[model samples]
Target: MKIAASLRAGVMATAVVALATFQPTPVAAQQASPQQTVRVGIHGADIGSLDPHMSAQTIDNVIHAWIYGGLVRFPAGTIDPTRIEPDIAESWTKSPDGLVWTFVLRPGVKFHGGYGEVTADDVVHSLKRAGDPKTSTFASDFASFDKVEAVDPRTVRITLKTPVPSLLGLVTAQRGGYVVSRKADQEAAGQYTAKAIGTGPFQLEEYRSKQFVALVANPDYFRGRPKVDRVVYRFIPANESRDLAFRAGELDLFYGRKEQRWVDRMKATPGLAIEVFGPGELRLINLNTSMKPFDDIRVRRAVAHAINRADFVKFVGADVVSPNPSVVPLGYLGYTDQVERFAYDPEKSKQLLKEAGHPNGITIKVLGSNRSFVEPYQLLQAQLAKAGITMELQLVEHTAWHAQIRQNLSAMVVYTAARFPVADIFLTQFFHSASAPGKPTAVTNFSHCDVADREIDAARIEQDPKRQLELWHAAQQKIVANVCAVPLFDEDQVWGRSTKLEFGHKLEASISFGPMLTEQTVLK
Candidate 1:
């Protein structure tokens, strides 16, 4: 059964406007045209501030796409041919030894305040800030860079401590490394949160917490002024409210509201369009290996065998979803379908339980947050019953869930990690033992698998592309074999927009709003 809730209070006026009587309403029609401002409905708030380094959520990343322009930007759709489009840095070259990377900054680009021309100094400062553990910038993935030096006004060189294959992909990330103005950095005295100054196509005009973030087009944008005059991102935490707002015309874009009934309705709607892309984002039940019950591999494997992935997919709509068998989704490079997912077998689960010395029924607490994950937990509760496994479901708010997960308080938790461009990022961030307990690593290896440490270390520095792939595949095989987590379906991101808006599916799960806000979008 599909479920949805409105994240906001009042009814969106836009929906009512459509139902209003047609009485010489040129202003209403004109505002509804493509020329007017585009309102986007997001599931969460503006994150309390617009600081890119503050958090690593998808919302923050989307905001950064406008506030700052990175050296490179991943184009929408497909990672195989791995397109690297120019952003702040137009082009770059790699040294023969692969230790040094030199990037050529785009000339004539200026910061928000009409500050002095952007140069290599800005790039160096940005990298240094990100690498500084004190600053706590989200670009720690590139923290391995030994030093960043300005070779020339337009050229900056990054010297890596070791050869890293995912370097290029890292630079394109929203938090990876964005060139910031030296003047702005010094003026803020290292407290640049809540304020932004960069060379992207949009400039932050105003940010009201829990309400909306307004951005105006950048006249001197290196890529050229964006088509839309102003972009408004409003938080609609409730799926029902967001859907209603979209239908009412209050929002031009909607994302991550995946109720099957809503998708079916939108599919039949004449003016709406749906796009599904590959490299599925895996939603899995993360078992805390540091804790009891899950600490045993046999118990974890039994839990994995008990859950029926096919039924779970069917319960959720499969038109835009699929069961993710491996940590790395299909269609990605080096992703082989060889990982054997444990099929649903009550007898096998019971036998494993007995072998694990659980002669009596096993009771496990399944934790989930919000509606997005509740279905999976509910299904697990029912399925585990067949194997004499007593599963208790706990539904908590998002903030509380984060707190509990960090404390490793739950036996099993439903969670997801956004897809990265390379497999190394996945391996190093999520499975590495060094990042297991205390570090603020995104990998959040909550599964606490100690064996993952050696494999992740090997994969991180494996220079040969083929060797790296082999190492990554081997590491994933180990994780799957141990049943660290039961992989489930990729959540479909659905958007409802006026016929004017146009954007396509992204190979990487990260959403890019720049394409849809282009000037080419016109109203009927």
Candidate 2:
């Protein structure tokens, strides 16, 4: 029986209602007996390239957060670009034109494994490397780079072709900004993949793939000695096993399920505490506009109408999930909700499908991650099925799914990501035509979108904040009207931690997508 639009909300609520019945057992006691060693249960089974400039996997990025530092960095537990603090670079100054910028580095900052103290040459080399398309996945972020040169051993200079809203964000301990050891990188002879050696509080000690990566405290670290003696980053992909290990006291911290029920259950556990905050990951289904049936705009609209946004809000719980009325993530610098939105109406969806000459309905194969993402994909499959659209899901390991989707192997892709919290960061990489998959400088344009290229490009160098926001708004309006991708909800980051652990700072926002173990973090 087809699920009518009137009954869609009820059906969606039923999908997650069973999960609420699951209650966690209250622990008799919680212990911090291990002293300083921290064991973390990551959601993935393995790490992707931790080479800073290449990896897109959340697992690798979290690892990068431990072993690397940038000229500037987000304060230990937050992702506020406005509150950036100095790391390698002690201070910086920009010329009147806002094109020429110079950074003065702190002297004697040592690299891991004795590569040598950081120098202007190292900063120059790393920045230049990040700007090179062949060497970095984040090359698109540095498009305005004109040149980077060493002024002296203590200073480096960067010249840009155009002004940006916040240059500090581009060079923070983010995507292409984490500085790698120039000497170590140069001598690795291509063995540098996932072997990150930087000036952070922890240094890589051992790495046994698919098992664990051991990191030891860096006594010579500029940030001071890490409170923990060692950090064991374990790879346990199964949610049940990970949660069991956490509850059994085998792990200090672990990634939790994103559903509200799981969070509430954890909240009820006496020994467990939940860390939920921003930068929230936005989940969206990118329908390949260049592919067969989706190439027809009417079919795209039909797919859009098929999705019931309210159902997702009800399923995830309003507090854990919020409506995304724009193409950009909520709370982003230039986010605007003045755009197109397709209301849920099954009859209109069917009519559109027939109008597009698909009276029998259409079938689409989709690539989905078999990790925490499985739930969302399952929900999506059920929703599409109700609209007479058959969604054949090919669930693969998280890492493989990340790789395959970049190759544009499927007609539909549901991607979850939280980038630098800027409108331009999401716009240029996600919706711009130049960043389309199969292109030389591709980041992620899974839908092969090109509708808003004009506004996206214009917003990059608009200069005025008001005019820039206008450009971004125009871009989102165009993209939504064309149904390039269905903007779903912004679900904040969630992690479960043992109450025995003290992360030093308050558990809040993280751009790394997981709790970062720093020099001050410890087992209470």
Candidate 3:
């Protein structure tokens, strides 16, 4: 919760080693042990929150996916809109007008830790909780909802303010869609945020803060018994330490570095299988339009033109990285690259800065995380320098970056995230005026841009697909021309595991943005 006072040495995060913190002195490999437990390493100092609705960060969401269930869900090990299957809901129906939906809960579904059976009441409560801005970080995603009610003991109904692009997407297992036990939440009071209770195949056994979490398999899990007996999820904040732990066989699977050199090195290690999968998180550089130099469009354009996206794509390696040309992530429904983009032109950058009344390049400060973004920012700082711009970085630890950015503490922000593969979801959260920082409905609109507010609002409810696409395109064009943010790269996640582990399903894409561990995940 607090940023450590000391600064880490300037090096790639994957090169900073702390052997004593992660490696075991001497022990048998976990894969060969009799426990059938898989030990996984996480990239955080500690979990930010366990409350499913509030788990907006990648690591916490990894834990949430194992603990919670949704009414509808993307298939295990993949994120695809067409293949959504039932989780808590056994059957569902929608009204003719598409404004109302009803679902029948699967019988005998029980919450973790003796919370008793999941009911329509629990579903209603969970959905409503997700919609409450005070309780959820993704409240804006549920803006279309009108009401939710328990139709009966097993049936629940949801009424929407208007027809959304995809009703099932909202209720599927991601972000605000994850359901929690109403009884458990009420009984636990404030304790529910720190410890989760759900009906997934795994249940929390113990949580030693700043260390690790032990989760035992749910014996009565609805899908079937979990193949693995237990999961030991450990927090290894440093990439180098986490990698050393994995290489030493202290961990069965760990998050991998998404650089070409690292992936190539890991591939050479016998028995290690590296997986690079999606949703490709778009790493963007947001220029704070509400602040001083950034308020001028020429300055914003100058800032954007100074850096080259190709340099980043090459640095990260073409295999692990996907180039993104627009503000919206590639493959989203309304994605387009027809909009204007400021290309990498150093001379043009200086000219624009001069027109904006700054002959000498202006300096901007960014608060970035040492663990997640130090290398990228360093490369960017050098790139900007060529065009007479100076980017000063105030480096902090990983968790602090998430906390500080929300408080609007940085003039520029280098943020990376994989959201629901929908244009409206990404646009509304990062581009909509309502989500601007310091506002009542603040999400992560770090740019404070309002150039295309009318277009964004109109597109979300346009109903006609063709017309909606037009509106969405117009919005992107406006935002690009205004230079609110520079689209960098679509970063596919990297993870390494022992080949002896079989994850039951094919690794393709995961809405969780990490490898999806399911009931069938097993040790071969």
**Once model 2 is optimally superposed onto the true structure by TM-score, how far is the C-alpha of residue 120 displaced, in angstroms?**
0.8
For TM-score, the strongest prediction is 3
Tell me the whole-model lDDT of each prediction, alpha carbons only: 0.66, 0.79, 0.81
Candidates in order, TM-scores: namely: 0.88, 0.90, 0.92
lDDT of 2 by residue, 387-442 (tens): 88999988997668878988888898888778987888898888899888878767
TM-score of 2: 0.90
Q: After superposing candidate 2, which stretches have Cα over 4 Å from the reference?
A: 1-35, 193-195
Candidate 1 C-alpha error for residue 132, in Å:
3.2
Ranking by lDDT: 3, 2, 1
The numbered model that scores best in lDDT is 3
Candidate 3, residues 396-467, lDDT tens digits: the string is: 977678789888888898888777777877887888898888787778847587888999888877878899
Q: What is every candidate's alpha-carbon RMSD to the true fold?
A: 5.4, 7.8, 6.2
Model 3 — which ten-residue stretch has the worst lDDT?
1-10
Displacement of residue 442 (Cα, Å) in model 2 is 1.3
Candidate 1 lDDT over 17-78, as tens digits, reads 22111224534653454434556678784554455655566566666766777788765443
